[model samples]
Target: MIHETERTAAAYAAVLTTCGDRASAKALARALVERQLAACVQMLPIDSIYTWDGKIEEAAEILLICKIKRADYEAVEKAIRALHAYATPEIVMLPIAQGFGPYLAWIDSVTR
Candidate 1:
């Protein structure tokens, strides 16, 4: 289990964001990995249902799943905001409860 105070550099985070289409999603993914903010970014097609501008809405979106060391989340969020086309992109981070030792180690190695 990861405690809140000790999560800065030692923990892992899975960041979530959505893009309107494939082109934008791919660009964001490349940027995150190239900057060493995330070890991997997986894109998946998803249908989103939400309320915006006081109205109900539904649309197709590309979900970006980014795996990164907890320490690098700030930089990652900044990078995403810079490149994202949406005015308010959904940038959320979730803690990784547990992962394979080798994979977790790889995440730490690739990110600062």
Candidate 2:
């Protein structure tokens, strides 16, 4: 379990974003990490099937796994929204329970 202090100052959130293609994913990932809103962004290619406008849709999507502090969520969200191609992108956060001390420290250092 994560302590209160850790929760207040630090957190890990995976921001799910899907781009039209690989190029867009790369561009978004680079921007996020460069801005420091995210310590890291992992881009993954995935096939997705969903419903839109009462129709079934299937497309190739890219997932952006963003590692960031709790304090940075707002900034991260703003940046992603600005860069996203979709009018309303999927942006969600999940709290990290615990992490390795050294790596967590590194995450804190880089993000701060």
Candidate 3:
């Protein structure tokens, strides 16, 4: 059965961000996990096309999906800004409405 909660304190989140290169992505992922700001960070290579400086651009990037506690979103965002090398980085959070109970509990155990 799918696990769901109405705790107002909705427990978990998946934060997304993209890094220009593999090295930076790995570094950021490591930092978040090491600091316990994220329970886990999954990285994937992707091609992106976006507009910047009034022009269209395309580039290869590494996408980092960070699993964290909902309450720590601000702190996680702050750390990303501090460590990220982008003039304006992509930082987005998706609420995890329902998840396996054990996995959600694990996220809680690892993150503050």
Candidate 4:
């Protein structure tokens, strides 16, 4: 059973970020897992339309959803910044409020 503390503690999180291309996205995903910062990273291709430098821009992007611990959020952001191609990358963290107990436990086991 999942406990209140487990459900509410900001420990479990999914960090989201975007890469300009597949190669970079794959590299970032591998690095995160290798460093034990993320237990898993799910990547998807996406089309992004946004404003930058006061102009609307569009590009093909790859989104990475990293399952990680809240404690590693800073490190994750730092890594993304270091490896990302964009001057300003999109790094967002969403807490995992509730999940399968076994899967959540696996995340804890795999991540430092």
Candidate 5:
């Protein structure tokens, strides 16, 4: 039987990342979902301000929110790194503690 933690309400996680542009964001999202690494991906345009090379920089970016299963995290991370344009892409996973039952069931069914 799957452990309590492992089976907890059907694992769900969101990977957050910023891409250089909409094209890149779309490409990454398609790749992840096509590969079954993510059940769904949502992209949004946003402004980013950060320090790089000891200089403050501001630029427009695309934020990608990926819905994936916890079991596929390693593969997802590897795939994202392989496809990501950034040398160190911001790939963060946030667990879903609670969600709509039907949606959660769909997520579990779609991913491995």
Candidate 6:
């Protein structure tokens, strides 16, 4: 059980990652949710332009936004590294400051 004042101690987190295609995104999303490392994963088609290997590059990718318990962050990252095709898959974690009470509870309940 979580204490009232300590809600932040068991806070929610949003993970950002990009995959080269939808297939990989789908597989990664399924694995995280199935393993209970994340409550939900939202995949979006996006166009990204950035520098890689000292050169500018542009590509289309699937962005995976995962809502999960902060406690499960490490496991989530590890799972991504294992399945991600990119030698350097982006895995960025951000704290969710506040959200609806029930929705936050659902996130905590679904993820370990």
Best-matching candidate per lDDT:
3
Q: Per-residue alpha-carbon lDDT of model 1 for 28-101, expressed as tens digits?
A: 99999988999999999999999999999999999999999877889999999999999999999998866677
lDDT of 5 by residue, 1-112 (tens): 6544445445778889889999999999999988888889999999999998899999999999998987888998999999999998999988876676677667777776
Expressed as tens digits, the lDDT of each residue in 14-71 for candidate 6 is 9999999999899999999999998999999999999999999999999999998887
Which pairs clash (backbone N, Cα, C closer than 3 Å) in model 4?
A: none
TM-score of each: 0.89, 0.87, 0.92, 0.92, 0.89, 0.91
lDDT of 5 at 41: 94
What lDDT score belongs to each candidate, Candidate 1 first? 0.90, 0.80, 0.90, 0.89, 0.86, 0.89
Q: Per-residue CA lDDT of candidate 2, range 56-102, in tens?
A: 99999998888888778888889989998988788888767667666
Error of 1 at 20 (Å): 0.2
| True-vs-predicted CA distance for residue 3, candidate 3, Å | 6.6
Please give the lDDT score at residue 2 for candidate 5. 52
Which residue ranges in model 4 land beyond 4 Å of their true spot? 1-5
Candidate 3 has a TM-score of: 0.92
lDDT tens digits by residue: candidate 4, 1-112 = 7584576466688999999899999999999999999999999999999999999999999999999988889998998899888898999999987778778778889988
User: Lowest lDDT 10-mer window, candidate 3?
Assistant: 1-10
> Residue 3 in model 2: shift from native, Å?
6.9
Instruction: Give the local distance difference test score of model 3.
Output: 0.90
| TM-score-better candidate, 2 vs 4 | 4
User: Per the 3 Å backbone cut-off, how many clashing residue pairs does candidate 6 have?
Assistant: 0
Clashing pairs in 1: none
User: Candidate 1: TM-score?
Assistant: 0.89
Which rank order by TM-score, best down to worst? 3, 4, 6, 1, 5, 2
The collision pairs in model 2 are none
